[model samples]
Target: MKNSFYLILIGCVLLACSTSKPEVVMVTKTIATKDTIRIANDSLDYEVIIIDAGFSSWLDSRAYPRKYHSLNYLESKNQLYVSEWNNRVLQPQLYNPNLYEMTINYDPMLRYGYEVNYLIYNYMIYFQNTNKQKLFGTVPTR
Candidate 1:
């Protein structure tokens, strides 16, 4: 089996304060290879990249199509997942540092559109199922 690659995208930090909204930091090492799963909003100039080698193929074969999950459902689940993921990132002692690498900055207030939310939501699901870890409760089944 091929080893899965993991890279921290360090997605946008959606700080509520007006003056300190940091832009998304793109990892220069990886660039946009076919294996990378990227979600970008040009207007906002914020982007997210999931650099898991297995994610691309898993998303295609295992995950349900975008239509299967509604925008609200995706956003809501992402809220839960991102919050827990960030928590795990903060406390590496408790959670595996390998599984929870970096903090994901996702703001419910800022609309990331359907595609962005869809990809992020599915990525979390893939992450949990593949890693045999749960960002929330149980490992979600497709």
Candidate 2:
């Protein structure tokens, strides 16, 4: 009977150890290719932006259903700055700033249907004063 009780205790200990959460690691690297960015394994719902000198075939492949509207117009340069409205946070103080500035380098081709290499920039926006603070907050302790 004593041996059986010890066995049960050992089993409980093993189960508890197995259920412990694993640690997460963060690493940053720059991309030098035209491939779509891989989503992080631990990422939740977050906004993203891509700024390109012009659109690419790769961009079309990863395009979301929602569309972006032009945010500002530069008449002198004849260029329009655009942003995804769905990714913007509607907070008074939290401004979704543009993060990337890609310059086009590729020649115009029939496949891509463009002559300029697109300069692309990406941005991730978060609301500063939303109840969704827990989205970026620390994990709770039980």
The superposed Cα distance between candidate 1 and the true structure at residue 81, in angstroms, equals 0.3
The models' CA-based lDDT, in order, is: 0.68, 0.23
The runs of at least 3 residues in candidate 1 whose Cα sits more than 4 Å from the true structure, single-residue gaps closed, are 1-8, 12-33
Which residue pairs in model 1 clash with each other? none
Residue 63 Cα positional deviation in candidate 2, in Å, after optimal superposition: 7.5
Error of 2 at 1 (Å): 60
Best by lDDT: 1
Query: Best TM-score goes to which candidate?
Result: 1
* lDDT of the structure predicted as candidate 2: 0.23
Residue 36 error, candidate 2, Å:
8.5
Per-candidate clash tally: 0, 11
